[model samples]
Structures are given as structure tokens and as C-alpha cells.
Target: MQREDNFTFLTEEPIPKVIGTMAVPTIISMLISNLYNIVDTYFVGQIDTQATAAVGIVFSLMFFIQAFSFFFGNGSGNYISRQLGARNRESAEQMASTALGYTLIFSIVLVVLGLLFLDEISVILGSTPTILPYTRQYLGFSLLGTPFLMCTLCMNNQMRFQGYARYSMYGIIVGALLNCMLDPLFIFGLDMGIRGAAIATVIGQIVGFAVMFRMSLHKDIIHYTPRNFSHRWLFVKEIIAGGTPSISRQGLASIATIALNVSASQFGDAAIAAMSIVNRIVMFIFSVIIGLGQGYQPMCGFSYGARHYERVKAGFWFCVKVGTAFLLFWSVVLFAFSDRAIGLFRNDVDVISIGIPALRYQLLSFPFWSFMIMANMMMQTCRKTLQANILAASRQGLFFIPLILVLPHCFGLLGVEICQACSDFVSLLVTIPIVFSAFREMHV
Candidate 1:
């Protein structure tokens, strides 16, 4: 709980410079992490459509785990950053360590529960009869590492909050690189097949956790100690209250993904794989926006806590502008080379044929989608839980479920592909009024 170098060092600098410097590292970090996921699909795709679909199912399962991690990590780290901004480093460290401890315990329980009901959970996550074995094989191993993944997220959030984004980026970069290198070795050399991917993922996360731990001890300004470890009800409640929206957002997406996979399964294994690949590619693109938004988050949280409303507004708009421009550019690139992108994971003619329209439709909506993402993140950082939850739920949870079901049933495969983008459009329309009211209220 000692005072160290403060992030207010950048407060006097230009907002654009501060954001760009911080956001770029975080974006690269996400890109590196996403590239590993793409590599996972690429290697597993060689095994067969079932294997690839298993990867997709596992990804959704991971998203469900991430929902809780984000809820706790963001909740705790948001307040920690604000406390640090207010020069209360002791409370900041306490919050950081407590959240990390809570996440580790939660992860252990999740792994047990996940493995205990592996078959049922696998089925619920959209595993078809053919894909169930592969899903179980991979998820079974990966579930064991859930604690590492969750703790890693908590550590990364704390590092980011402490303004040590560079170290965080290194941890992720090293882990991703290791995962990519190990994928082929485990998949082919060791003859582990789809389960090999799971092993590599866990190994990569361990390496990440190690690096983050070192960064926490060596580079972090606010350090955790066992002496000041007593739990406080108010702090825990505050963390939950602040982070509830993120939980709702990620939790809803988990539900929606399960729904998408289930509905996609009805069309056949090819449809499922096609939709899965489409999701991976689109998610990679979305991660860039998310990474940038994450960089803005600590700043927004800190500034808002300090009552620097103008800085919060400035940071929000900066993210919006950068996010919109990047999303627009990526959308065009994805659209222009949609065929090449779809063909990267699989050579299945049916998958490529079905995926092209789906990819194009989803990518086309990225520009408008930026507004929803920015708004949601802004609300979350400012601790506007209800508004943030509503915004978070809009596209995936609320609008998407009905759209995915009704559209596919009515219009068939094309409708399934178009449903998400259609939901995104509606969400954007709904967001405009909310945005106006939010900005108006921000002044007060």
C-alpha cells in the first residue's frame, strides 16, 4: 500500500496520445490471443468437421466461464483503479488481491461442476451426437484449467488497472505464441488429436499465469499483502454492483451462443461448422474493438470516480471514433475477401458456400455495432449497471435469441446468417435514444 508512480502522469498529456499509447498495446494483445484461437480451429479442422465443431462448442463453454471472470475482474479492478486514482493504494491492493482470491475459488468450483456433468453440459452447449465425444474429450481436459483461465483474467485486469498494460501484453503474447507453436506438435506429433488442442491451451494459460504473477510482484505499483486481507461486505457488494452489467452481457452471450449452435445443428454438421468458423472470424474482429474499449475502461472508471466528468466524456468519444474507424476498415477487408477467409479453416464446399453470406452479413454491421459496444463499456466503467446491462443484452441476449430462432425458421439458412446482423441493426437503433439521454445525464 505504498504510493508509487501514478498514472496521472498522462493526465496532463493529450487524450488522444494517452489513449493511443495505452490502447495499441492492448489491441495487439487481443490480436495475438485471437490468432491463437484461429490457429486452434485451423489445426483442429484438419481432423474433421466434428473436431472443428467441438472447438466451437468448447469456445462457447469458455465464454460462459469468462462471464463470471469478467464480472469479478472488471468489478474489482474498476474500483481498484478508482481507488488508486484517489490515492487510496491500500484499498486498491486489498480489492485486487481479494478479487483474485475469489476468482480462483470460483474457478475451482466451476471445474468440478463442469466435469461432474460433462456429458449434459456438452450437450447443452450444442454438441450433436457426432460431435459430443470430441467436445467431451476437449472440454474435459480444458475444464481442469478453468481456474487458471479465471485467475489469469483477474491478474490481467489488475495489471491493466495498475497501468501496467505492457506487462499484461507480454503475458498474453508469450502464452499465445506458445499455444500456436504447441498446437501442431500436440495435434500431429503426439497423436493426441483434438484433445491435444486442449492440452496446448492449458499449457499456454499456465505460462500466461506465470508471467502475470511475476509482473504482479515485480512491476506492479500497488502490491497485495496477506496482512490486510480481511473481507469487507461493502467492497464485495460494490464490486458486484459495478460489474453486474458485464456479467449479464457475457452471460447472455453464452446463452445466445448455445442457442445459435443448437439451432445451427438442426441444419446439419456442415451448418454448425460453418457457423462456428464464421463466429471465430467475426469474434477476432470484434476483439480489436474490445481491446481498445478495455484500455479506455480503467481511465473512464478512474476519472468518473474522481468526478472528472469531462475526461470520461473525452475518453468515451475517443474510443467510439477509433473503434468505428477500425471496425469499418476491418469489415470492408473481411467482406472483400470473404471467400478467402472462410476457406482458411476448412475446404468443405458446403461450409464455404453457407459461410460466405453469413460472414458478409455479420461483418457489414460492424460500424453500427461499434456504438453499442462503446456505449455498453462506457456505462459499465461509469458504474451504470442497469443501463450497461440493457445495452449489453441488446444484440446477443435480447434481440438475438428471437431473431436467430424466427429468422431461421422463416427464411432458412440465409435467415440464420442474417439474424445477428439484423439484431445488431435493431440494437443500434435502440441505442441512439439511450446515447442521447446518457450524454445529457453525464453533465449532471
Candidate 2:
């Protein structure tokens, strides 16, 4: 009965209301998930600047983990939503189980490979001699939690795509809150330093995975059974089509972070630390818009599959307006308090000085992200894989990679400061035409 009602609610609810209902839980979940980093950065900062920088250095690995999780989650979730929209429960169940099966396999591989290459991976992630020990200590423990973290994130996306975002939020909130609570205990109370922080994170992820896995067994939600798992070419094609945009977006983000770190390393540890703080702050702000887009994704997938093109367009425009307004307000707030915001994570004078300009520059481009992100989400959900993949790659891959490489050489430290802002502007321009073309094709 609830499942039937969900279909009715998704299809028949007013656009704004439907999106609002969905967006709240998703926004909360995104915020909590980001707190894993924000909280870790804060607690670890208490030890010393190098410890904080170590967390930042290992952040790219976190991004790499998320890239694959999103690949499987978004791919399977999008397909599941479309199949559910078409009233095909069997197909949806199969995709869900298949995604879960592959997620576990891939995550185990990551853990083994990551642990085996721990030292090399640390160097590649831009860990300096001063930060290397802390990096290895923190990263090794984090790798152990890879399976739990990846599986939890994968299940979270699948649940949200099924319109069970509230249940998803419960699991994430529990984990994030546990991490927050344990951070002080492990980092300061136990005197374990950075190692404690890593332990807390792994424990939190393990618990979160347990909660979400239990939720997955609920009758209304699709259960992941062995019988439903498959490696058929048809399932693989669908997953790839649905998931590739996320891979491009998130995978490129990891690459972009590594590039930023390498460029900043030339200027010394202060530069790396400052830029790392700025990136975390920006990502926290950006997560709001991403959550808004996630809320709209299921609506887009269902409506598009059901041929309700008008609802898809309505949800897209609504999200863009709301998301842009939110960013506009926060950008101004952060710009005014740039020093304090950066200082909140690390109070070093060098870190604060370098972070202020970079944070402000990034904010200048924040308002434009709403349209760019929403458009990409819309295209991906509608199965415009090529356009979606192009848009996904534009910000971090196509534009940012080139600018980060060239600008720092030409302008020194200032180039690192403004590179992301420049990339955001160019990505927005590229997104405009692709989105327009997408809408015209839909006759919207």
C-alpha cells in the first residue's frame, strides 16, 4: 500500500511540494556526510597544522572512493527509478541487487590495493615529508573502512532514488553523529591524535552500513537478494549509461584535487593547507546545491520515464531558482567572514591569509553553480548520457585541469587562488548551450 502511494505521490504531487519534501531529507543527509570531513578537519586541527594538512592530502582518496560509489549508486538508482516509474518491480530489484553485488566486489579490491600501496598512494596524493607520517596513519585506517563507507553511500543513493530518502537520512545522521561524538574522545581524550580520528570514522561507517543494510530489507524497499544479482550485458549497459556522468564528475573532482594539491605544494605546506581548507569550505557550501539536485533527480527520472516532460522541466527550474538564491546568500556571508571561516578549521596566520582570497574568489562563482549542477542532474536522469557526461567533466576536467596547470605557473600563488572561480565561470557558459539543447529536444 505504501509503495503504491509512493508512486501516486511522486507522479501526482505538485512540483514544488514534491521537490521540497524530497529535498529536505537529502539536504540533511548531504550535510551530515560532509561533516565527516569538516568534523575530522576541525578535531585534527587541534593537534597541529600538519595533521590538518594530512587530512586534506588524503581527501583526494576519499573523492576517489566516492567516484566509484556514485558510479554504481547513481547508475543503479537512476535505472531503478525509471523501472519503478514504468511499474516494473522485477527490473528494479535486479538492478538494485546487481549494484550491491558489484559495489562489494569493487570496494574489497580498493581496500586491498589501497593498503598494499599505502606509501606510494600517500606520495601521489601530495603528502610532503612533514605530513607524510600523519597521512599514512590516517589513510591506512580509512582504507579499512572502504567497504563499509562505499556500501553505505551506495545504499544511500539507491534509497533516495526509491523515494525512501528519509530512511536514508536516518542511517547517515546516525553515522555522522557517532563520528562527531567519537572525534574528541579518540583525538584528545585518548591521546591517539590523528589515528584516533581515523578509527572513529571507520567505526561510524561500519555502524552506518549496518543501519542502511537493515533498512534495505524493509518490504517496501527493494531487497538485495542473491537470486536477483546479475552480470548480464543488458544490466551492465544500463548501469554504465546511467552511472558514467557521476564517474566523470566525481572522478574528475578527485583528479582536480590532486592537481590543486600538487600546484600548491610548490608554494610550501602553508599553501597546501590553506587551499585545502578553502576547498572543504567550498564543498560544504556546494553540497547544499548538490542535495537540492539529488532531490530533483528522482522526480526527473520518474517523470521522464512516465513521459511527464512538463513536471521534469518544472522541477528543474524550481531547483535552479531555489539553489541559486541559497548560494547567493551564503556567498555574501562567507565573503564577509572569510578569515573567520578559514580560521575555524586552522588558525595559523599563513593558512588564514592564503585561504581568504581563495574562498572569496570561489564564492564569486557560487551562484552560477545552481544552474550548472541542476542542468547536469536533469540530463543524467533523462538518460542524455553524452550531454550529461560532457557537462559533468566540464567544471573539474575540461576547464579546471588546464587552468590549474597553466595559471599557477604564470601568476604564482594568485593563480591557485582564482583557478576554481575561472573554471566555474567557463563551465557555466558551456552548460548553457547543452541545457538549452536538452530542453528543446524535450519540447519544453
Indicate which candidate wins on lDDT. 2
As for model 2, its CA RMSD to the true structure in angstroms is 0.9
Question: Which sections of candidate 2 miss by over 4 Å?
Answer: none
Q: What is the C-alpha lDDT of each candidate?
A: 0.83, 0.92
**Candidate 2 least-lDDT 10 residues:** 435-444
* Residue pairs in candidate 2 whose N, alpha carbon or C atoms collide under 3 angstroms: none
Mark the regions of model 1 whose C-alpha exceeds 4 Å error after superposition. Answer: 1-5
TM-score of 1: 0.96
lDDT of 1 by residue, 1-444 (tens): 223434564344567877777778788888887876798999999999999999988888888888888888889877887787777877887887788878888899998899899999999999999999999999998987788778877777777766667776877888889999999999999999999999998999889878867777764455666665548997788679767877778888888888889888988988889998999999898889888888887777667766778888888888888889988898889999988898899989988998999999998788976678878888877777778888988889889998887988888888888988999989898878887787888773
Candidate 1 clashes between residue pairs 3 or more apart in a chain or in different chains: none
Residue lDDT tens for model 2, 1-444: 998888888888998888988989999999999999999999998889889989999999899899899999999999999999999989999999999899999999999999999999999999999989999999999999999988898899999999988887877888899999999999999999999999999999999999989888888999888999998988899889999999899999999999999899998898898988998899998988999999999888888888888888888999999999999999999999999999999999999999999999999999999999999899888889999999999999999999999999999999999999999999998999998898888853
Error of 1 at 241 (Å): 1.6
